[model samples]
Structure formats: C-alpha cells, structure tokens
Target: MEHADEVYDVIVVGAGIEGSSTAYNLAKFGKRTLLLEQFPLPHSRGSSHGQSRITRKAYGSRDFYTQMMAEAFAMTDELQKECGEQLFINCGCLVIGPRTADFLSKTKSCLKRYGIPHDQFDIYEQRKRFPALSFRDDFEFVLDKSGGLLRSDKILQAFQRQFVRYGGVLCDGEPMIDLYPGTIVSVKTTKGLHRARSVVLTLGPWAAKFLPRLGLNVPLQPLKITVCYWKEKHGGNFNIENFPTFTMNGAAGKHHIYGLPACEYPGLVKICLHHGPNIDPDNRDGVENDWVLDAMKLIIATHFPSLEKEPSIVETCIYTNTPDEDFVLDVHPTWKNIVIGAGFSGHGFKLAPVVGKVLGELATGQKPSYDLSHFKINRFFKTKL
Candidate 1:
C-alpha cells in the first residue's frame, strides 16, 4: 500500500456504486481522488453487487428523481460507450397497481409530464398482452418503454475501471476505522492514515458508525431485504426475453412487491418484498425473521400462478432507509469539507451516476447541478449541526 504524505483532492470512503461513481467524476475532472473499500472488489457484501437493478424514470411522487433519471440514463450511455460493453438492457417495465392507488396515478402523471413515452393497459389489454400475469379486475398497468434492467455488478466494475483509467487511486480491503474532521480531513484506515482536502462518505448501512463522530444524526435504518427467486412452472415463461421488469404498488399492505425477469438463474424469476426486518450490517446473516419470505410466497401464489409457490433460491441485501424514503445528499452539518450520501432506501442504484456527480460537486465546493433541497439534512432536524 502506497501511503503518500501528500493530501488527496478527494477521498471517497466505500467503493459501492455511489462512491465509485463519485470517484470517477472527481478523477475525470482532474482531481486527485482515492477510493477506499472495506472488502475486496466484486464482493456481494454490499448492495452494489447485485446482478440487476430496475432503472426507470417512473417515480411516483419523486419527480426530481424522474428528472435526474434523464441525466442518469445519459451518463449510463456515455459509460457504456467508453467501456465498449453493454451496461443497461432496455427490456421495458410494467407498473401495475390498483386504479385508485396514488402511486400509480402519480407515476402516470410524472411520465406524462416528462414527455416520456408510456402506455396504459386496461384489464383486457393486460390479459391479452401478458397472459401469465394474474391481477385483480380493477388493477391497471403502465408500460414504461424507457425503463429496464441495469447490470449493477457490471456497472460498478466499469465505473471502478474508468475511475482508475482517469487517474483515481483505489485501495481495496482497507476499512476506514476513524475520521479526523477538519479543513484537511485525516482518514485513518486499517493500514495507514491518508489525508484529503475533502471526504465523501458513501457508506451504505455502516453510516451510523461514522456519522456520530462527525457530530451529525441522520435517521438511517438498515434493513435486511430478502431477495427471493421462484421457479417458473412452465419453462421459459418468465425469462428475460419474454417478461419485463415489474412492480406491484401497495401489494402487501404498506410495502411494494417488485420482480425482475429471469436472467441470473435459469427458469427462476427474481421476486422480492421491498421491505424487510432491521438488522446490523456486520451481523446480517442468521438474523431471525422470515416474514418477507412468507409474504413473497403468498403474493406469488395469489398474483403469479405461473410461478412456483416456493422460492428456488433465496438471497439477502441491505437497504439503508430514511424517514421519508428519499435520499440524503448534502454536506455535513459542521464540517463543510465532509459530504454524505446515504439513506438510499432501496431505490438508489438506478441513480448512482447522478448521485456520485452531486457528491463530487459538493465535496469540491462546486454548486450541485440539480435542486437538492428535497435531500437536505435539515428536513430531519430543525437546529443546524
């Protein structure tokens, strides 16, 4: 490990999608950037190591995210061209829910407002178009042509590669132990101490450990989500070539149920409950609770009769959620040189590019390109840190 005495322009802790994207942007802009990762590259311990994530501009109430998706998609395209490899596969998406559901209405309105091409399918049309899907008679479906699946693991790898090519230093297997906040922040890792003009903390579920040291309290809850994949009763019925990514709003009480087409596992579709039990990130395994699995089985049996009731393969991932389920993207309260990007709330992977850019801008003392008032930390607290 090269522990140089020189101060870096920016040091990004956590080499997940958000941190990697920020490092790429900082390095591209000619900043001396260093990315620190707790685990080795391409590990499944973090949220960014998934095979696929839904990328869409069909946000329900969050129109800012919809607007940001325009740039996010563009950045994805730019990265794809630069890497000469496909990162996103546009297989379309279906947003299905009750007609009276506010999320459905808001999503449809948001899509129309942004001039994104979309279509609404009634019960008869939906049945004719997707014969395998079983929904209530009053349920509605919206087809978002621009939405699809993003290869999350591939995107993370591409971003890390491009960041290195652009002159960014990446230190894997080096966990940040402490932070000495100041104009020039001192980042103490397990191996050595590194100094940076600014620090960006993109810690996923481990933000709670470092936020208090920085004298900030953000209501962040880390959840252990159950990623369940069910086998198709008939072969090739729910494969990527035929089925589109989908979400059922208000499916199981307060939470939404989402699923991706079968791609990672042959003949098995990835369907999961959007919410899960709270658990520690370090002790994520064997933390008791199977409510999510039970709910998945019920939903699949009720709405997706073509799929098997039992999950063929079950996995786990973590989601750090905020109170309002939005993101926290702002500079630290007391430390101006420290910026934080947290509380992704399960929907952050799609916006990693723009999120990284915003974090980089904040770290470099540059004005953010987008309106971030919705993501400010003050929304959670009245007094300034």
Candidate 2:
C-alpha cells in the first residue's frame, strides 16, 4: 500500500508566503503537511523579504476581488491573534492618477460598487493634505482609508510559525530537485527523496524548472525588481506621521510606483518601480541597471522633492510574472494531486493568506473560498505543450 517509503497527507514546495499559507491551512485541517524551502530561513533571495507591502481593496471593476479583501483582512487579523503579533497598520493609502486613467477610474468605481467608504479629493486637496506629494493639476486622488501596510516578513513568518504550531513539518535549505507525480508524489531534493500523498508547487521563479519536465509549460516571465531606499532631505520628512503608503500612477518611465513610510530602514524610505528588467532567477548577479535607478530617482526628485537625490540603500528581488498579471492556480493536468500556484506578478503578497487557503482546498479536493475562474492554469493554454 506504500507508494514510497513514507506518506504525508500533503507536501508543499517553496516556503514563501504562498507555500507557508498552504501548509498552514492543510495542517490546521488535520492534514500532515510538509513545507519545503530551497533557501535557508530568513534569506533575502526571493520576493517576500521586504518589510512593508501595501494592501488595499481597490480594483478597476473586479467586485469579486474587492469583496475578497474583506476576508483577506479578516484572515490577517486571525493571523495576528494566532501569532500574538501586530502585522497590519491602517496608515491609509492614496491612489494618484488621472481621472480617466484605468487605475484611478477603476478604483473609484470599485469603491462605489462595494459602498466602501473613500474620500474623493481634488488636485489641490491632495497637495494640501499631503505636502510630501507634489502632483500636476492633471492628476487626481482617490484615498482609501481602510488600506495600509502589512508587515510582510512578519506575515510570512507568522504563517510558518502557525503551521509549525499546528504540527506541520518544515524542511528548509533543501531544494526540490525533481517530482514524479501520480496518486503519490515522489520529491527528489538535495537532502533526499521524500514521498507524499499530494504535492503543491508554489516555487515562484523556480516553478518552470520542475513543471516543464512534467510537460506543462507556462508563459511566466521572471524579472529582477529593484528595491530602493531614498534618504530624506530633512531627515524625517518621509516619517510615518507625514507619509502613508502612496501609489503613484502615470509616473514617467513606469506606470506605478509605491512607497512606504520611513519606518523600515531609518532615514530611508522604500520606493521603486512596480516593473523591472527581465532576469533569470538562477543568475541574478551584479548590481542593478543604472537606468532603473535613474528612473526612480527622477520620480523621487520630481514628485517627492523632499527626498535626497541619491538612493541610500538598494536591493533586488525576482518576480515570476504572468502575461495577464493574474495568478495561476490549479492541479496539474496530468496529475490531479499536484497543485500549482504561480504567475503572481508583483502583487501576490496581499493575497497570500487567501491564496494559501485556496491552494489548501485544491490539494484536499474541497472547493476554494473564492472564485477560481480568473486564475486558471489553462489561461496559458496556447503556451502549454
């Protein structure tokens, strides 16, 4: 009856937010879960290492996702209580773009559709309210008070801790080398070959490494994103009291740029483009391109005039983006017990808790809490062989 040496109810690969959440939920549901990580714990090699991530309910017209935020926020609350730590801060977020632009218009529409309380401020009002931001008259603002920053690393660690609290096994620093999918999955890692009843691949940038061998090809673009910290001209101009998380649209050289208050890196505030140069996650060597840094500095100088021209600190992270900028969540076509979650692009952090819940549901053959239509594995049908 043994398919391999030993059996587990579920095995999850990748210890990022998605993998940890899936393992946490599976263990909470009484499944013997094994969470695997290629890198050592607390490594900054992946996308989930940052201190702050913006969380909001604003979407263009996607009411379903707008509604999902309620549950996502609730889950964050549950995580905070379970971990006995504060993970979210309601610092408010400002969405600045043209009134006719997709980002701005959709945000207002979604806010109205859900009757979510938001403030509509004019150009003058925005400039008056937030002196740190100096926008042209053409730009408008949609302020959502409910949105704020999530202590991202804390959230991931909380999930990992919670998963362990629920009797889940965590195997870090062991990269998953191979997968033989069937009713039971045989995973080959640097440590050894392990077997489990079901396997969930949330490998992020490394997803294609194992998936293509199984005859499934997805159009996932791996890019290197720059995380930069700019020094304050007045030393505390970008402090939390003066600055909240701001999302700027229609910025030159990039569509969106987000910045957190100067709480993470001392006198430096985190700001960078939402996009980055295409990169291979395996060989993310050398420093970032000067153009990317220049673009961000230009925006900071033009908009956030109070920040020092030079970036105080800089780091890099990899994002495995899908073409449509949506997520891919489904069981492998050839192996039903093998679940996959990828194509998170740049915005996967906020939905990590809920995504983990859905991945757990998929692995257990239970219906997911949210709609799975927009996030199907077959979206890349033409690309898949």
Clashes of each: 0, 0
- Best candidate, TM-score: 1
lDDT, residue 331, model 1: 91
Which residues of candidate 1, in runs, are more than 4 Å off? 1-5, 252-255
Supply the TM-score for candidate 1: 0.97
- Candidate 1 shows a clash count of 0
| Top candidate, metric lDDT | 1
Give every collision pair in model 2: none
- Give the lDDT of residue 26 in candidate 2: 91
Residues 11-113 of candidate 1 have per-residue lDDT tens digits of 9999999999999999999999999999988788867778899888878778899989999999999999999999998988899899998888998998898
lDDT of 1 at 22: 97
Give lDDT tens digits, candidate 2, residues 142-245.
Answer: 87888889999999999999999999999999998888877778899999988888899999988856678877788788888888998887776677776678
Relative to the true structure, candidate 2 reaches a TM of 0.96
**Residue 272, model 2: Cα distance from true site in angstroms:** 0.7
Please report, as a residue range, the 10-residue window in candidate 1 with the lowest summed lDDT.
Answer: 247-256
